[model samples]
Target: MSDGDEPAVTGEEVRNVADLARVDLNDEEVETFAEQFEAVLADFETLDEVPEIESEPDLVNVMRADEVEAGLTQEEALSNASETEDGYFKGPRVS
Candidate 1:
């Protein structure tokens, strides 16, 4: 339950969990997984020692100010199109 303590998971518990998850486990696998689970949980307990810090990040306006700009005319825009209908790019029917 805590760091530096033996993992409390048992083979029976592992077997029960495996059964619930529809996983087939033999006695050997159950024993192996019980030990593995304990080691994993013990590793997780070490995370408790990580120092907590402010969650907020530095706030800054990194974006450039918005400005109106000249855009391509309809003729220039449609010039590259493989197909155009009524001054608009024509795509294939979807339905």
Candidate 2:
């Protein structure tokens, strides 16, 4: 296909992308991917042709009110802990 106003996808770009992904593609596969990538870019250009949307939809928060809730205390939470130190659960230190 002839090159358009936008730069055409290149086999080198396809190969580079494949290499970054650790994909092993032959020369023919690279050419195929380049064509496919070019088609995707061409399709994306269609977005520019879409008419601007004028209407705006009403937006509102749909969440419950935040409120204080009862929870287990330090002693109660530590009860299930195999190791506790300074009124809290002690875990193995990770370097």
Candidate 3:
């Protein structure tokens, strides 16, 4: 809301929001919260006065290209396993 204008929000509106959020607010608290909401909205009006930047955003490829690589052999892969069965790592059994 602009300066000198009535608040866009009212006590009834604030109470509705509080109810939706499951918040408990007395009548005085609702009025206070309504005023705070109006002030916050008024503060946001200042952002409209900010100048917009006129430039294309610079974008870059941050990731390296994928390359083919050699992987570990079966024996190397299984060398450190605490337990193995056939050609696979064996994990603890679950019920």
**lDDT values, one for every candidate:** 0.88, 0.86, 0.89
TM-score of each: 0.65, 0.55, 0.70
Put down candidate 2 lDDT per residue, 1-95, tens digits, no spaces. 33566448888899889999999999999988998998888788887789998887887879998999999887898998999898988999999
Q: In model 2, which runs have C-alpha deviations exceeding 4 angstroms?
A: 1-7, 60-95
Model 1 misses residue 70 by how many Å?
3.9
Give the range of the ten consecutive residues with the poorest summed lDDT in model 2.
Answer: 1-10
Tell me the deviation in Å of residue 64 in model 3: 3.3
Q: Evaluated with TM-score, which candidate comes out highest?
A: 3
Error of 1 at 82 (Å): 1.6
lDDT of 1 by residue, 1-95 (tens): 53546457988899899999999999899989988898788788878778998888879899999999999999999999999999999999999
Residue 9 displacement in candidate 2 (angstroms) = 0.8
TM-score of 2: 0.55
**Which candidate tops lDDT?**
3
